[model samples]
Target: MSNISIIGLGGVARAIGARAIEGGNAVEVIGRDAAKAKDLAAALGGGATAGTFGATPVGDLVVLAVPYAGAVPVIAQYGDALAGKVVIDVSNTSNADATGLVTPDGTSGAQEIAKAVPASAHVVKAFNTVFGHILAQGGPLDVLFAGDDARAKASVSAFIESLGLRPLDAGGLEVARWLEGTGLLMISLARHGVGNFNFSLGVDLPG
Candidate 1:
């Protein structure tokens, strides 16, 4: 099992921390509010612990569970602390109404975040397509991920599997834009086509 450090105190952070702990990975919860981070870590149990905000994470795999707007700022704050770490960007760069992406025309939120991190650090886009509650509920969910580094993707794939989920690589980091678009599509589906938020986007294979 991989040592995991999750940045955020939201539903997404809670879900990932819980699953990571359940998978026997060491979990460290980090947030701006130290008390809340401790509370969340305590709540998670299973040897979960709280980490100092803006500090070098104790885990090789760092999960950035913050919203898209906060992603870059948080990375900036962490600075060189994230060097050599496989950073997982789990944020969606969608507008408030979920009408479209907030990222620039060509680049994605993940790609933009990648630019902010250290040269040695790798950014892998993932978990943006899944709802926190559904993930918390636990099941064999398909997690689509994109990253430029093969080694980083492999590490993330193993981490996803540790959470009882399947990891599907959606090509290089350049593909993150499409993944973000897919995230927006999921929201639109929930509000219009699907009429609810309890469902997840997935694939069906011909067996």
Candidate 2:
């Protein structure tokens, strides 16, 4: 990936942006609060930027790091500008489970993002479950990514690998629903004290 645009300057975006900068990619960070974006960009120190969501330049890949509800409106604002771009959905739907905790649902934030963006946009689901605290370590984790477009999926997989994270292709756009749900189900673990946000999904198939 040559350039990466991160939409949202939250903790998640910050972690991912820092990793992107470390990888030598020119990063543009867009957020509602200009001060926060500038602060983050300054910290990144590798051609990072602060701007409105619409001002984000066209890049090899774009990462949506905002809440679920925020994704649709941002897509609308971008319009045709997002055509042919690879979009990664790294947000959860904020739902919970049987115990008053975030429940993972069948339809996820990724699916919703695909619907919101133009058909020309290759939207991939990823980064939703990784916590900011763990992400900053620049270590690898079992990351599940879903997209209908093979080229786009491959591109995102490469970016994930750059962060030292393992990539798992979860089939197509629909698989995003399950991935989103998994993130929500994780919330229950934290609520019940069975696990904190540190809970992560790891797959170890019998070889």
Candidate 3:
């Protein structure tokens, strides 16, 4: 069983943790609010535990499932406790209010997260482009992400595959600029009421 610690208790975190437990992984759901953490953990069931900020530093995969602005602070909060662990950044850095990417001069959200955490930890971008609704509903869902570390990427890809989803390796963390932007586009498309295009797409290759 994989030791998974999700560093947020929200819709996205719930969706991901639920799926991970279904895949036979041990999941610890964390939150600043302890009561909320217990509620969320109870919802997850089967040996899943609710965690406070003081929980043990024991996840094989640490999922950063908070907002874009909270990424670095979360890393700082975890501090030396997370050294040598793999971080799965599922936070989208796009400004939902402004409907645009929020990082500095062409830097992507996950890339920013990588900068914040200690070098001892490996960071991989995953599950940011997809909405929480689709993940909970279980689609032929598509998870798009990038990372500099090959082993880190492989580990996250395995988790995604275990959930019966497609993992699209969009190259190095530099590609996060595009990945982050796509979240805005996805919301716009859904708001525009283009049913078929809402959270779904296809690509054609010329022979």
Top TM-score: which candidate number?
A: 1
Clashing pairs in 1: none
Per-model TM values vs. the true structure: 0.99, 0.88, 0.91
Best by lDDT: 1
User: lDDT for model 3, on a 0 to 1 scale?
Assistant: 0.81
* Candidate 1, 1-207: lDDT as tens digits: 999999999999999999999999999999999999999999999999999999999999999999999999999999999999999999999998899999989999999999999999999999999998999999899999999999999999999999999999999999999999999999899989899999987887999
Worst 10 residues of 2 by lDDT: 95-104
Higher-ranked by lDDT: 1 or 3: 1
Q: How many clashing pairs does model 2 include?
A: 8
lDDT of 3 by residue, 3-114 (tens): 8998899899999999998888889988899899899999999788987784555687999899988788878877777888899988777675747667877787788778
What overall lDDT goes with each candidate model? 0.95, 0.79, 0.81
Q: In what order do the candidates fall by lDDT, top score first?
A: 1, 3, 2
Please give, for residues 1-207, the per-residue lDDT of candidate 2 as tens digits. Answer: 557888888889989988888877778888878888899889888888876768635577999888776788988888877887899988877643333223235556676677777778889999876767778776668888899999999999888877778889989988877777677666777767665676566678797
